[model samples]
Target: MPFAGTSPHEDYTAAVERVAGQALGVLMDAGGAVVPAGFAVADLHAAQTRDPDADLPGLRVLGSDALAPHVLRGTPVPSDRAEAAARAFAVFPPDAVGASPDTAWIVTWRDWATARTLTRCGLALDVPAPGDGAQVADATSWQTWSVRMAQLSSLALPGLDGPIHAAAREGAEALSRGLVRSMLRRDYRTAARIARWIAWVAADGVAVPLDLAPLLRHVRVFGGGSTRTVLDTRIAQHVTGLEGS
Candidate 1:
C-alpha cells in the first residue's frame, strides 16, 4: 500500500521513495545479509558490483569531513518535483557515508536526486532522447553519478551551500547523454579530452589532487560518467596537472 496523493510533487516523491528503496534492497541483498563486513552501510552499496570503468570522477569532487545527511538532505533543496524526490532519498542518513563496493550504487542515488531537482525546478535536463543505446547508458551513468554526487555533497564547504552537488548533478546529466557515443564510435581521443576537462573541473571544485595517467591507462574510450575508467583517469589527471596546462 502506498500513500495516494493528487499533487504531482507528492506523487513524484512517493515514486522516488519506492524506487530508491527497491534499489537499496536489491543492493543489500546482493551484498550479503548485512552491510559488507568492513564497510559502513552509508558509504558502500552492497548490491551492485563495482565496475572498474565506473570511476569517471574520483573522490576529489567531494569536500572533506562529509556533509552528514541531516545537514544536506533537506537544505539547499531542489525545486524540481522529481529531482526533489530523489535528493530526498539520496541523503537518507544510512546512505550518507560508508564503504560501497559498487560506486554505481552511489551514482544511482545521485541520479535520483537529479531527477528530483529537474522536477522541482520545472526545468528540462537538456539531454537527448533515448536512442542508439544512449538511453540505457544515460540511465546507468546517472545512477552512478548520483551516488558519487551524494558522497561529494556530504562534505562541508564554506558559504557555497550545495553548489558542488549541483555542479555534480549538471555534470552527471551531461555525461549521461553522450558518453557512450564517444566510446562506441571508437573516439578514444575525444573521450580522453572530455575526461581531462571534466575531471579538472570536478577536482578543482572539491580541491582534491588526483593523477590521470594511471586512471586512464588502457582506457580507450567510454561512455557513462561513473563506469568509465578513461574518463575517471582524465579527471584525475587534470586534478594533478593543474599547472601543466
Candidate 2:
C-alpha cells in the first residue's frame, strides 16, 4: 500500500516545484528582461533524490544564489518576486536555517510561517504566549518577536477560547513596533505580510494599536495586478469559509 502521507522526496520535490513556479510567475509578472537561471530546479531534484545531505546545497543554489539576494537587496524585480522568495524560504525545513549565514533569513521566515500555521490549526504546542519575556535586540531577536506577533495573531482568530484575547492584547504593542519598523524601512512586503495578521486580530474583535488601514491600502496599490488578486482571493476564501466565494 502507498504511504498515507507524502514521502520525504515527494515533499522536497513539491517544495522545489512550488518555489520555482512562484519565481517564474514573478519574472513573468515583472516583464523582466533577465530570465531566472534554469539549472536550480534540476539541481534541486537531483540533490533531493540522490543525496539527502545535499539539501542545503540545493537550497543555496536555488534560493540563496538565484532568488534570495535579489529579493533582499530590493533589486528591480517585481514586489511579487520578493514575496514569492519570502514564501519559498518559509517552506524550508527547520534544519535548513543554519546551513549558511547567507540563508539566515530563513529562520525568521520559517518561524513566522509556523506561528501562522499553529494558530490556524488551533494548536498552542510549545508556542510562546504573551509575557514570555522575549526581547528584540538584534536580527535574531527580531525574528523571534515576529514569531510572537504571528502567534498572537493566530490566537486571536475566531472560535478560540481561554486567555487568547488577553494574550493578543498584550502583544499589540510589540506588533505595532514591528509594523512601524517595517514601514520606516520602506519594506512594504514585510509590512503587508504583518498587516494581514493585524487584520486577522481585528477581525477577532481585538483592537490593534497600529493603523494598518493605510499601509495595507498602499500594499494593494503597489502590488502587481495578478498577485494582488490572488492574495485577496485567498484571504476572502479563508475568511468566508468558501472555496472561491
Best by lDDT: 2
Which residues of candidate 1, in runs, are more than 4 Å off? Answer: 1-169, 206-215, 219-245
Clashes within 3 Å, all models in order: 44, 0
In model 2, the runs with Cα more than 4 Å from the true position are 1-92, 99-167, 223-245
Candidate lDDT values, in order: 0.34, 0.41
> Any idea what lDDT model 1 has?
0.34
lDDT of 2: 0.41
Candidate 2 TM-score, C-alpha based: 0.38
Q: Which 10-residue span in candidate 2 carries the lowest summed lDDT? A: 236-245
Evaluated at residue 14, the lDDT of candidate 1 is 32
Candidate 1 structure, TM-score to reference: 0.21
